[model samples]
Target: MKITRRIHSCVEISDGDTTVVLDPGGFGTPDNLAEVDAVLITHIHPDHVDADALTAARATNPELRIYGPEGLRELIDADYNVVADGDTFSLGSLNVEVRETPHEKIINSKELPENLGYLFNDTVLHPGDSMAAIPDMEVVLVPISGPWLRMLMVDEYLAAHRPKRFIGVHDGVDNDNGLTLRGGLLRQLAKDHGVEYLPLKPGESVEV
Candidate 1:
C-alpha cells in the first residue's frame, strides 16, 4: 500500500484497486479528494473535519462512503456510517476495525462521548487522538502530539505497541508546541525502543 501524508493527521492510503482517505481535513481541499473511494474520519474537531471540504467531496462523489465515530453522524448531512468501539466495516478491499478511545475530558460536553482509532486492512492502525496498545501491523500511525495527548502518554504508547514502523502525526505543524519538542524526543525514543520512527513533513509520501 502507498500512504501519502497530506497534512496533520490527514492521509491518503491507496492499494491500487482502492483508496482510503483518513481525516480528510486541514490540508485536504476539494481537489485532493479526487478519485477517493472512501473517507474515514477519526473525530469531529475542525482541524480533522472541515465541513466545506467534506461536503464538497461528498457532493462530487455521491458514491463515496463516509465513516466516523458515534455522534458525528448527526453533525453531517451526507450519507454516513456511524461506528463505535469494536465495530468492523469494509470499504472495497480494505477491512476496518474501530476501537474505542477514552475521552480527553477537555470540557463537560456530552457530545464528545468517545474517540476512535482504526485498524485498516489489518496492517495499519490509525489511532485518531487516542493512545493505543500496539497490534500486529507493518506500520502504525502514531499521534506524537496533540492538545489532549501528553508526551508521557506518547512514550508509553510507543513502547507498548512497538510496531515495526512508526509515523509521527497530529503534530509538527501549525505552531503546535509539542511538535517542537517531539521531534527530538521521538528520535531518542526510537533508539531506545529499537523501532523505526519517521517524522514526515507535510505533502510527503511513504511506502509500506
Candidate 2:
C-alpha cells in the first residue's frame, strides 16, 4: 500500500484502485480529495474535519463512503457510516478496525466526541490524534507533535508500541516550538526504542 502524508493529520492511502482519505480537514485541498473512494474521520475538530473540503470531495466523488465514530453520523450529511470502537469494516481487500480514543486534552469535555484510531489492513495503524496501544503492524502512524500530546506522553507511547516503522503526523503546521520539541523528543525515543522514525513534510509519500 502507498500512503501520502498530507498537511496536518490528513493522509491518503491507496493500493491503486481503492483510495482511503483520513482526516481531510484544515489542510486538505480539493485535488487531494478528488479520487477518494472513502473518507475516514477520526474526530470533529476543525483541524480534522473541513466541511467545505469534504463537501467538495463528496461532490466530486458522489459514491464516497464517509466513516467515523457513532455520534459523527449526525454532524455530517451524506451517506455516512458509523464506526464505533472495535467495529470492523472493509473496502475491497483493505480491512479496517476502529478503536476509541480519549478526548481529555484534545477537545473540550462537553464537546468531546468519540475519537477513533484505525488499524488498516492489519498492516498499518493510524492512531488518529490519540495515544493508543499499538496493534501488530508493519507501519505505525503516530502523532508526534500536537497540543494534545506532550513530549513525555509521546515518548511513553512510542516505547510501549514499538512498531517496526514510525511516521510522525499531526505536526509541521503551527506551534513551531511544540513541533521542534516533540521532534527532538521523538528522535531520542526512537533511538532508545530501536525503531525507525520517519517524520514527513506535507505532500510526502511513503511505500509500505
Candidate 3:
C-alpha cells in the first residue's frame, strides 16, 4: 500500500487496484477524484471539509462515494453514507474500520463536533483530530498541532499505541519553522518510545 500525505489532515491511500482519499478539506484540495473510488471524512470542520471542492469533484465524477458522520449530510447536497463508531466497510481493495473518536474539546468551546478515525486493513490508523489511540496498529497518523492539542497529550498517545511507524498530521496551522521545530521534537520523542517517526511534507508519499 502507498500512503501520500497532503496538507493538514488529508491523506491518500492506494492499494494497487483502489485509491481512497480521507479528509480533503480547506487545508488542501485533493487531486481530481475521477479515478478515486471513495472518500472518508472524519468530521465537518472547515479545515477538514471543503464543500466547494468536494462539490466540484462530485460534479465531475458522480459515481464517487462519500462517507462520514451524520452531520456531514447537512453540509453537502450530494448523497452520502453516514458512518458512526463501529462501522466497517470495504472500498475496493481497502478494508476500513471506523472508530468514533471524539474531537478533543477546545477551551471555552460550547460543543464539539463528531470525529471518527479510520483503521485501514487493520494495519494503519488515522485518528483525524483526536489523540485517541488504537491498539496493535502498525502505523499511526498522529496529529502534531491544533487548538486542542498539547505536547503531553501527544506523548501519552504515542505511549499507548506504540505503533512501529508514525506520521504527523493536522499541522497546516503552522508556518515552516513551526513544522520543523515540532516535527523535530516529535521525531526524538517517538524514537525514545522505540517508534520510527516519518515526517512527510505535503505531496509526499511512503510505501507501507
Candidate 4:
C-alpha cells in the first residue's frame, strides 16, 4: 500500500486501484481529490474536516463516499455514511475497522467531540486526535502536536502502543524549529521502544 501524508492530520492511502483520503480538512484537500473514492473523517474539527473542500469534492465526484461518526452529520453539509465503533467496511482492496477514541480534553474548552481511529487492512492505525490504546497494528499514525497534547503525553503513547513503526500527524501547529525539536525527541523515543519512526513532510509518500 502507498501512504501519502498531507498537511496536518490528513492522509491518503491507496492500493493502486482504490484511493481513500482521511481527514481532508482545513489544512488542505488531498492532491488527488477528484479521484478519491472515499473519505474517512475522524472528527468534526475544521482542521480535520474541511467542510468547504468536502462540499466541493462531493460536487465534483458524486460517487465519492464519506464516512464518519454520527455527530458528523450535524457539522457537515454534505451527505456521508455514519460509522461508529467496531464497524467494518471495505473500499476496493482496502479493509477498514473503525474504533472510537474520545477526543482528548482541552482545558477551558466546551465538551470534546467524538474521535474515531481507522485501522486499514489490519496494518495501519490512524488514531485521529487521541492517544488512546488500540489493538496491535504494524504501523500507527501518531498525533505529535496539538492543543491537548504535550511531549510527555506523546512519550507515554509511544511507550504504550509500541507499534513497529509510527509517523507523526496533526502537526500543522509547529514551525520548522518546533518540528525539528519534536521529531528529534520522537525518533529517539521510538528507538528506545523498539519502534521505527518515519517522518514525512506534507505531500511526501511512503510505501508500507
Candidate 5:
C-alpha cells in the first residue's frame, strides 16, 4: 500500500488500484471524493472532515461510500455507514479496523471531540487529532502541528509508541521557516526513536 500525504489531516492511501482517503478537510483540497474507493473520516470537525468538500464530491459520485463516527451522520446528510469503536469493515480486499480514541484535552471545561483512528491493512494507523495510546502499527501519520499539541508530546508519543515508520501530518499550520526547522527536528526525533520519518510534503506519496 501507498500513503500519500496531503496538506494537513487529509491523506490518500491506495493499493495501486483502489484508494481510501482519510480526513479530506480544510487544509488541502481532496480534488474529488469520487476518486477514492471510500472515505474514512475521523471526526466531524471541519479540519478533519470538510462537509462542503464531501457534499461536492458526492454530487458527482453518489456511489461513493463514506464511513465514520455515528454522530457525524446527523451533521452530514450523506449515504454513510456509521461505525463505532472496534468495528471492522472491508472494501474489496482492503481491511479497516476502527479504534475509538479519546481526543487530547485542549480545555478543562470543554468536552473532548469524538476521534476515530483507522488501522489500514494492519499496517498504517492515522489518528486524527488524538494523542492517546496508539495500537501497534508499521507506520503512523503523526500529528505534528495543532494548537492542542506541543513538540514535547510529539517527542514522547513517538518514543512511546515506536512505530517502524513515522509520517508527519497536520502540518498545514507551519510557515516556511517553521516547516524547515520543525521538519529537521521531527526527522531527527523519529530517528532517535528508531523510526524512519518521511518528510513528505503535500501531494507526495510514499510506498510502504
Candidate 6:
C-alpha cells in the first residue's frame, strides 16, 4: 500500500485503484479527493475536518464516500457513514476498523466530540488528534505536535507503542525550529526502538 502525507493530518492511502482519504482539515491539501473510495474522519475540529474542502470534494465526486463518528453528521453538510468505536467496514480490498481514543483536552475549550482511530488492512493506524493506547500495528501515524501534547507525552507514547514504523502528523502548529528539535528527538527514539520514523514534508509519499 502507498500512503501520501498531506499538509497536516490529512493523508491519502491507496492500494491498486482504490484510495482511502483521511482528515482533510486546515493543514491538509489533498490533490484529489475525487478518486477516494472512503474518507475517514477522526473528529470535527476545523483543523481536523475542512468542511469546505469536503463539500467541494463531494461536489466534484458525487460518489465519493465519507465516514466518521456519531454527531459528526450534524457538523458536516455532506452525507457520511458513521463508524463508532469497535466498528469495522470495508473500502474496496481494504478492511477498515475503528478504535476510539481520547481527543487531547484543552484547558479552556468546551468538551470535544468523539475522536476515532482508523486501522486499515490491519497495517496502519491513524489516531486523528489523539495520544491514546492504540493496539499494535505495523505502521502508525503519530501526532508530533498539538495543543494538548507535550514533549514527554509524545516521548512516552512512542516508547510504549513502538510500532514497526511511525510517520509524524498533526504538525501544522510546529515552526521550523520546533519541528527540527522535536523531530530529531523522535528520530533518535525510533532508532533506539529499531523502527523507521519519517517526518515527511507535505506532498511526500511512502510505501508500507
lDDT of each: 0.76, 0.78, 0.87, 0.88, 0.84, 0.84
Question: Is candidate 1 or 3 superior in lDDT?
Answer: 3
Rank the models by TM-score, top first.
3, 4, 5, 6, 2, 1
Residue 113's lDDT within candidate 6 is: 78
Candidate with better lDDT, 2 vs 3: 3
Candidate 1 ranges with C-alpha deviation above 4 Å: 26-30, 107-111, 172-180
Model 1, CA-based lDDT: 0.76
> By lDDT, who's the top model here?
4
RMSD of each: 2.4, 2.2, 1.1, 1.2, 1.4, 1.5
- What would the TM-scores of all predictions be? 0.87, 0.89, 0.96, 0.96, 0.94, 0.94
Off by over 4 Å in 2: 104-110, 172-181
> Which stretches of candidate 6 lie above 4 Å from their native place?
none
Q: On residues 1-208, what C-alpha lDDT tens digit does candidate 3 reach at each position?
A: 8999987999999998899889998977777555588888999999998988887788889999999999998689898899989989998888999998778888774587899999999888888888878765788999989888887887887787788888899999999899878977898788878888888988899999
List, residue by residue over 77-130, the lDDT tens digit for candidate 4: 888899999999999999999999889988875788889999999898999999
Model 3 alpha-carbon drift over 4 Å, by segment:
none
lDDT of 2 by residue, 1-208 (tens): 8888887888888886888989887765436575778989898877888877777777777887888876665556666787888999989778899878776475565466678998888888887778777644589888766666676876787677778888888784658776677778778888998888877767788888
- How well does candidate 4 score on lDDT at residue 95? 94
Expressed as tens digits, the lDDT of each residue in 1-208 for candidate 6 is 8999887899889988889889988666576776678788899888888888888888888899999888777776888898889999888888888999888887765787799999889899998888866546688998888888887877788778777788988888889898888888888888777778877788899998
- Model 6, position 72, has a per-residue lDDT of 74
